[model samples]
Target: MTEKALTIITQREDLPQLFGKRIENQAAIEEIITKIETESRSITFDIETKEGQATCRSLAAKIASAKSTLDKAGKARKDEYTVTADLIQVDRNLVKQRLQLLQDEVRQPLTELEQREKQRQAQHETKLAALGYLDVQDHDRIGSKFIKERIAFLENTVIDDSWEEYKSQALETKDNALRILRPEFERVKQREYEQAELARLRAEQVQREQQEREERIAQEATAKANADAERQAQQIAQESERKEREAKEREARLIAEKESAELRAKQQVIDAAKRERDAIEAERLEVERLEANRQANKKHRDAIFIQAKDDLMANGIDEETAKQVIKLIHVSKVSNVTIKF
Candidate 1:
């Protein structure tokens, strides 16, 4: 069956069309593509022979020529359509711009109303947030007194008709802010109390340590004083004992000297008595020795005289004359007239 060829339906005032119809050569281009595919299958390329290569190159030239023709035709047709499309786009842009202007003009009052409503809502939200605004930041650093003041201020704030439609919400926000602040206030107060209690405990501990140190020092002082007193007493006792011993030694030495002096005096008297007795004995012995020697001398002289007298009698000498001669010689009266005796 042969289908009818399509045609471009540009500039059609038919049925309020929004876009142009397809190009007129579209069906003919499809038939041409089918015919080219069937013909290309019949043309074989044998690159092993020179004639075959020449034939293949001739076929490639023909195909390239056909391709160039088809490209030019397609580009020309596309250019014609592009010019029409560009003109339509210009008209469309002009219509859209005019419609946009009309639309802005139509919505001006509503836009103003919407803007005013948005501003009113923003103002309402800002006022409501202001009612609940907690200016205290850094809860840990805030003091308990400041927290209390904030709570009091929040509790006393009035939610009146000035809030208008958001009065209830404002009141609720203030109450919620108070509820949050009151607990924080109590927590801060508790922390402060705990810190104060800890400080008090530390102070007590320091005072206790100081007291114990003082007591220990006092005890040490007392013990040292007692020790010093004991040592001093011992020293005094030892000194007293030493002095007493020294005095006793001195007394004993004095007594010994006195006894030695008396003994020496007695010995001197005994020595004097012995010397007198020895002198008397020596004098008596000397006198007795002298008397004995005188007697012996007299006996010897008488014997010698008798012997001489006997010899003289025998020789015609008298005993009385010999005795006279002996007496003269003994008295040292005769010079050369001594007897032999």
Candidate 2:
């Protein structure tokens, strides 16, 4: 498929004119645009080199100059048409303004009458709204007296010729407002009575509370006085008992000190006598032990000597010679010999 060439070309063959004047440079402008479009196809630059960068700037300046020339040509061609349109608009506005003034002059009387009628209707609406002002409110501040006055005012108000066509509506609105306010008056009275009763109860409650508080204060004062008296008696008793106990303790301590001193003296004497008897008994026991040891030694030596004499007689030796030999051994006069008992 063949791709379309991106180029500027004038397709219309109609005569070039703006605001009944010939576009003298229309063909020249088309020729310039085509030249620029053709030149744009050849535009090339490599920013890495100075010459290429200069070529890029030169091509951009040429494109900008071509756009400026085309813009000036278009503005010059449209300026005449714009001035003609402005003249037409000014003539049309003048004609419309003159016709409007004529029409207003013709309708002045009827307009004034209509405006007065509108004002009268607005006034009637306002007055009718005022008659129905007793509509139920979420937070009603109207008291019973105010409600009664409003009801009486509504009942006495005569809907007459002054109300014009709204007379019946005004009378109905007054009746309805009275009907609502009359019942509201009774409710407001009940609420007021309840509030008064509540105030009365609160006053009585405050008085009773004050009396009870005073009684409690008096009872507390009496309790404090009795407690003070009892505390004083207890303090006195404690003080007296403390003094008596301290006196008894002092007397008892003195008597105990005297008895302790006497007992100490007696113990010292007893300890000394006991020590003296122990020393005498120890000396007597030592003497008895030495005498018993000496007697035992002599008895053992006599038995040994008798056995030696008997043994020598059995061996055919005479007793007198054995006796002499045993006496010599006992005295250790025999060499390298001993008699063991």
Candidate 3:
């Protein structure tokens, strides 16, 4: 088939026409691609090596079988071709389909491998350039050295066995390589997964720490607020106490002043009463002295009037004069004495 027709056939949606089986091994193809990737990294390629040559020979055999089947189908009689084409097509198509499937499956993985190799080569070039040991023209020298080393190793290794033993040994070596490499690859992947989980846990821990710090700060703020409130309350209580004390002092001062004023009023009343008693005593003494003086003066006046009447009677006077003198004496006796003594 032409390359264009082959491409169309591979891209066709009808699976039975292109591939022999109804359900193509798409998942197996993917698994094989992964296995190839693992093997490419660990196993070195040696075109001259027996194992390498054997793989190439098997692929060539499959191609030859497909071509022979196609030739036979085309050369058969028209009636025979019609009946046998379907059976021949199934066998021929299976071989071609497997080859195409492997190519398709390896294409993307091989591209990825090439990219990785380029990056590695670039890094190596950068390092070698820094050390002044790299030459762009001599890039294939390293690949030539690797090929020479593989050839030398194959030549030196002795294989003294029948074809069956050699095949068994080759199979054993392939199995051993897979066993060793598969575990190592899995370990590397597992380590990467573990590192990712560890990073997530660390992030969670940091968030928890930040939350705890915030809670601590809030608690401290609340405690400080409570303390400030308590202080304010204490200040208010103190102010109230001070006001109460001041009021009590003022009340006491008023009581003392009022008591002092009352004492002064009582003292003044006592002094006035004493003064009134002294004035009444002085009036009584004066009245007693005036009564004694009046009694003495009246006694002196009575004695004088009696002495004058006796003297007038003894004298030889006219009857009328004597009588007048006696009359004066009797008048003095009847009238109240006007003594000025």
Candidate 4:
């Protein structure tokens, strides 16, 4: 039978219900398809005529064009949104596959990232709540450990000879702040120590000066008494000589002169003793002054070394380097000593 005369069979919904007027206008498209299929089954011309095949192909192509035109007018070429919605219906499986890929490569990762951020925020909040006592550097150090990513961010700063520069360097690497703080600690302690030592030295000096003054007053009184005793002995010896009128009296006067000589010699001995004591006291004061000077010089040198080292360390120099600098600085300070006979 001719294909147009053959009934079309389908398990899907009836065609008229879906197609509306487009189906009536393009009815020939289906009729031609049916005719081609139906006539192809018959061997009307023996050996399957080539002309009939060509004619059938042409009719199939024409049907395809008519169906395309009808589809464009009916539903295929609707407004952009409408056609897109219709396209979604036709391409559901392909779109679903693409969407699944996006979920795996893009959407899924984004969702997981958000989840991780939420978890991280909760953990950070707990840590932050616990870290009320820690400074910024300490807090970041803890964060470096607890957070999944290391936290080492710090803004760049201009460094100079000031303590601010050292503080900035210390903050840049929280772990190495000790390098800066240690020098500063020593510097502070050295300053305090020097001040205390200076005060002590001053007190000792005042005490030494008082002792020297008292010693001077005592020596002057002893010298005055010795001089008075020697003068009185001399006057007695002169009076004894004047009284000498006889040989026995002259002998008595000579004896008196011998006694006077002994007294003068004794006074010289006492004066020598006083001189020795004064010399001893003077020597002691000199020694103390020398010692005080030595200590002051030492403190000054120590202060210089501390300042230099602290400056280097604050500027991000390592301990070994700072030590070298300090050593050189210490070495450059030559101590001068003078000796006299």
Candidate 5:
């Protein structure tokens, strides 16, 4: 017999009949299909035949092709709703330019302030050295009171230098403190920036991976849905075929039973007719046997009488005496007769 084609649809709620009974629920159909699939897989896995392998490969290829088509369709629909690449690129460029401008504006003023502070620091150091040299020269030339007075004047005149020296020392201390801390602080700042950049990259990578995973899952889901539909359609086709086969088998069985009954009836009729013929033959044989026995007895009796009469005539006896003797002789010999004559 040629095999019928099959198709399965996932959304269908009712399956075709199997053995005259309808399968109404998709869940039941699914369970049966699962079992069939499992059994088919097991059989395929166990078999070593080239044909079996080829059949399995063909089935797999068909499934793969169906999945690919579903995936393409899903992707097409998704593309219709998704954001455009050019818009994203434009937004990214704008943010990058703004950040660069902010960094340049902050760096320029800070550089100029640092350079002027360095010049003032050098000038203040030179003035302090000149005031100290002048103080030393005036110390040996005058009396103590005058020397003290000149010293006071010099000290007074050098107040600005001393102030400048103090200010320079303070500035040097501040600069030195800044010098010691700046590189380390900048290094910390750079590290913070690098850490932020690294974090941003990691976040972006995580997001991309998550998005990819979601897409893969969606594709798998769509393929599974299509496969389920195909399996259901196949199950429905199989059920319909099974029901048709069962109906044919049942009809054939009924026909066979009718033929068997008719044969039995014919055999009984033949046996009865044969019995009647046998009875008639037996009656005919019995009648023939009776007729033959009667004829034989009559012939025997006639021969016995004839023989007695001849014996009487030859012996020269009176008719009555001869007759009596013949009767006796006949009676005695009758018991020993061998032939009818």
Candidate 6:
């Protein structure tokens, strides 16, 4: 008996009879691969010849092509087969063992790093709390806000040298706070004393002004009273002077009336004496005139009588007889008339 050979090449319609079992699209894939092998034969070369370097490049390209086909075949095989529960469990256990081995390698070191970080944070907090407490106790020496800001700046330093630098900076801030504020206390106290003295002097000035105002008001009241009294005295003196002048005028008028009456009585007596002297002179002149006329008449009568007597004597009549006739009939009278017989 002779052995028959296996053939991979088949037609698409007879792939199930050639394999003696039912397969999925095997005959179609065989037909496509047979066409590629036949058409790609022109790319082959002899390794020992000059063109043999191209054979290395061709071998690399064939390897890449084979890797891509193997990946596709793996995906297709996974799709065609069903995974059992036991197989999935076995794969999960293998992944868990690898993860546990990696965690164990770093576990102790990670715990130590976490504990160290917690201790560093706690020590930094304790130092900051102590700084705040010192400022609250004596605010003049240490300022809380100043120290806190300095410490915060120090905390953000480089991570490799964080602890030692932060500690050194926090201690330096506390020392500087005490040095700056120690010398400012005396100046503030002296300023307060000067302000108190100025307030006292201003109060004294206001009291003196009030006293002077009261004295000026009193002096003005006294001056007004004196002026009113002087005006009243002047009015009384004027009234007295007017009454004295009127009394002197009345006395002078009475003395002038008495002198006028005495002059009128003396004039009446002198006029009566002049009238008596004129009457006596007129009576004496009348008596002298009457005596002179009587003497002349007597002389004339005597002469006429003597002449008549002489004529009688001469006519021879007796003188004694004629005398007797003259006596009887007054011859002087008869002769002027001639005697009639």
Best by TM-score: 1
lDDT of 3 by residue, 171-290 (tens): 454344345444444455565678789989976875676556555655654565556555655655666577988656655654565456555545554555455546655765787799
lDDT of 6: 0.44
Error of 1 at 322 (Å): 99
lDDT of every predicted structure (CA atoms): 0.57, 0.60, 0.47, 0.48, 0.46, 0.44
TM-score per candidate, in order? 0.40, 0.36, 0.22, 0.28, 0.23, 0.24
**What's the count of clashing pairs in each model shown?**
1, 0, 0, 0, 5, 0
Instruction: Name the candidate that leads on lDDT.
Output: 2
Q: So what's the TM-score on candidate 1?
A: 0.40
Cα error, residue 100 of model 1, in Å, equals: 0.7
Q: In terms of TM-score, how similar is model 4 to the real structure?
A: 0.28
Which of 1 and 3 is ahead in lDDT?
1
Q: Which stretches of candidate 1 lie over 4 Å from their true place?
A: 1-88, 130-143, 152-158, 244-341
Off by over 4 Å in 6: 1-171, 218-341
- In model 6, state the lDDT of residue 129: 49
In model 3, the Cα lDDT at residue 332 comes to 75
Tens digits of per-residue lDDT, candidate 4, 1-341, equal 43332222221233222332235444322433344344433423211345654444443343334334334333432333463454423333332343334223322333455587687766645533332233333332233232212221211222233323244434445434334444444555565678789989977986677667656765765676567666765665676676745545655665677567666656765676577668867977898999999989776766766677788899999867887766754566435521111
Error of 3 at 14 (Å): 65
Across 77-193, the per-residue lDDT of candidate 5 in tens digits comes to: 334534433332332233234323432332334444556768777666665444332222222322234433433443454233445546655444444434434344445456567
Q: Rank the candidates by TM-score, best first.
A: 1, 2, 4, 6, 5, 3
lDDT, candidate 1, at 29? 39
Clashing pairs in 4: none
242-306, model 2: which lDDT tens digit per residue? 69776566556545654564455455545554555466557657877998888788778877888
Once fitted onto the true fold, the runs of candidate 2 whose alpha carbons sit more than 4 angstroms away are: 1-99, 135-142, 145-149, 152-158, 216-341
| Candidate 5: residue pairs that collide | 7-233, 8-233, 8-234, 9-233, 10-229
